[model samples]
Structures are given as C-alpha cells and as structure tokens.
Target: MTESDHRAKLFGTDGIRGIANMEPMTVETCVRLGRSAAHVFKDGTHRHRILIGKDTRLSGYMLENALVAGICSMGVDVLLVGPLPTPGIAYVTRSLRADAGIVISASHNSYQDNGIKFFSRDGFKLGDDTEHEIEQLTFTGRIDDIRPTASEVGKATRIDDAGARYIEHVKRSFPNGMTLEGMKIVVDCAHGAAYKVGPWVFKELGAQTINIGVEPNGRNINVGVGSLHPEVAA
Candidate 1:
C-alpha cells in the first residue's frame, strides 16, 4: 500500500528471490538493488569496492551484469568471482577487503529461480537494519544525484583465482596432519556453484573421488542431482 510496505517485502530471509527474469529478480530490480547497495556501502575518499559471486544458473550472467552496471553507475568498483559458492563470496569479500559482497544464488532451488544476498566487509550477512537501509534507498529516489563522472566512475574486475582461494580455505579446516590419502569418496556438486571446485578439493587431498553433477549447463542444477538426489552419488 505504501513504499515502506513495498520495501518491507523486498527482501526475505535470504534476500530477494524469485523466478529468473521475473518480478523482483528481473534485471531492472537487480540494477536498483545494485545501486541501492552501492549507495549504502560507498564510504569516504577510498575507492569503494563490491564483490559479487554467483551460481551456475543461466540467468546468473544477466543478473550479474545488471548488478555490475548499477554498482558502477554509483562509482563503486566491482570484483566478480564468476561462480563461487555463497560462503566463498563472503570469504573472498573479506580477503579482498571489499566494502561489501553479493551472492547470486537460489540455494537448493531449481535453476529457474535465483536470489541476491549481501555481506558486510567483515564477511558476515548484513543485519536487518542494514538490509532495511538498502531497501529504503532502492525504493526512494535518494542518491540519484550522487553520480560520479569520467575518472570517478567505477570498473569491474574478474577474480580468476577466487575458486582456488576458496579451496585453500576449505582445506585448512581439515584436521591437522590429516589427509584423504587411501580414501575414496563420491562428490555430487548438483551442477551448482561447487561444480568446479568440489571434486578438486577431494582430489587435492589425495582422495580417489567419483564425481557426478559436475557438468552444469546452466539449466541442470538441482534437477535430479545434489542433496535432493543423494542416490546419484550413493
């Protein structure tokens, strides 16, 4: 009924989510979200940067680009880590000291659905108050005149080593002096974000890994694979 009501409904438990190319998940909404998030996190003199990561959904590319455009318009740099896991985005966001982080994913949802969530520089999810501020900025026409021009405009960079970095971080969590040597394991990536780095982690740890659901065609994620279909790996 009012802008406040609309803002209240914009984000959910895990951020804005919907069917790809529809309603809140559409490019327009993503652009606004990008702009709003950028405005919220863009701090003083230092060049502000936002890290963005995504899953294997086909629409991820479209939404990712839209977010980049919106963030750049606010004169904030964007670091894109292609298709890393959600937590990986948070890790890399802190590793790179970004002002904020974003993840484009729908978790266990079908590939047709996608979501956007954010993180603070501390690699933690933004509090409800922070999310509310972003929503408020998105619906209001505020920050419309804060545009930077020429050299002040932001740019985007692809973090090619993001996946490798995440793998290293995960490996560190293993018990000290422990290795997967002499062990065999099955890994089903569900054709999702971990598709690339999932098996790699096991293999690097000296395990004989039988990998499935590693080949994602952007539409096959979670379709008869992943935890939903544990039998595939079993």
Candidate 2:
C-alpha cells in the first residue's frame, strides 16, 4: 500500500471504529492502539492506570482482552469494567483518577461492527493531537522497543462494582424530589451498552420501568433496537 493509504486518519470524532474483526478493528490493531495510547500517556514516577469499558457486543471480550494485554505490556495497569456505557467509562476514569480510559463499542452499529474511543483522566475525549499520536505509533511501530519487563509490566483487574458506582453518579443528576413514583417508562437499550443500567436508573428513580432490547447475545446488538431505532421505544 502507498504511504498515503497507510496514513488514513485512524481515529474519527468518536474514536477508531469499523467492522469488528476487520482491518483497523481487528484484534491486532486494537492491541497496537492500546500500546500506542500507553506510550502517549506514560508519564511521572507513579503507577499509571487505564480504565476500559465495553458495550454488549460479542467481540468486546476479544477486544477488551487484547487491550489489556497491550496496555499491561507497556507497564500500565488496566481497570476493566465489563459491558458498561461509554459515558460511564469516562466517568469512572475521571473519578478513579486514571491516566486514560477506553470504550469498546460500535454504538448504533450491528454486532459485526465495533470501535474504540478514549477519554482523558478528566473525562473528556482525547483530542486530535493525541489521536494522531496514537495512530502514528500504531502504524509506524516507532515505540516497539519501549516494552517494560517483569516487575514493571502492568496488571489488569475486573471492577465488578463499577456499574453501581456509575449508576449512583447518574442518579445524583436526577432532579431533587422528582421521582417516577407512579410513572410507567419504557427503556430500550438497543441490546447494547446501557441495557442494565438504563432500567436500573429508571427503577431507582421510582418509575415502573419496562425495558426492551436489553438482551445481547453476541450477534444481536442494534439488530432492531437502541438509539438507532427510536421507534422501538415508542
């Protein structure tokens, strides 16, 4: 391929995404991207932590594992919050004071599609300069030699309470004294990221919550639900 072809912008406004298990979205690319991001955020004398979250896509397990492997290989510890919403990941990242956060999702895309997005410790998405840096590192292999050894190699852990923490954070945003005490609400999570949290939020607020599109079995996300199909909630 030509240099120009290789130089395509890997990260879009929403992060790097495409058909899952394909080209830029493949396991290899995700791993490289993870390492590249670790390189960019590597700093200071203290331990660095990266947080990862994912939607309900089947391939999320693969991508999440690949990211953990890559980031840990670079000596950056990883916090894995399985099947969480993108926004929640950002919140957790900032709340925990992690160096960075990653979200694995295809958004409104079908199960065969997926993408990766990053957030800074401040909960904001990484900007163009950072994204470009990550892309360059992945494509050029410039930092392949920066690997850390035994004692320095980072670790990964699953944070089972992350979802509850995020839920509590979101609940604090509900208007004070306003409860859905007697209201019937239908939440369509698109069988994607917000499945559990969506209903949980409504119920916690006192709503008679009815949820749809909350079941994701690998290849079913966004099949005919989620924000992509508002009609499903209607």
**Best prediction by TM-score:** 1
Tens-digit lDDT track for model 1 on 79-140?
Answer: 99999889899999999999999999999999999999999999998899999999888888
Best by lDDT: 1
Residues 182-233, model 2: lDDT tens digits? 8999988888888889899989999997889888898888888776778877
| Candidate 2 lDDT score at position 128 | 88
Deviation of model 1 at 58, angstroms = 0.5
Candidate 2 residue 165 C-alpha distance from true site, Å:
0.8
Could you tell me the TM-score of candidate 2?
A: 0.96
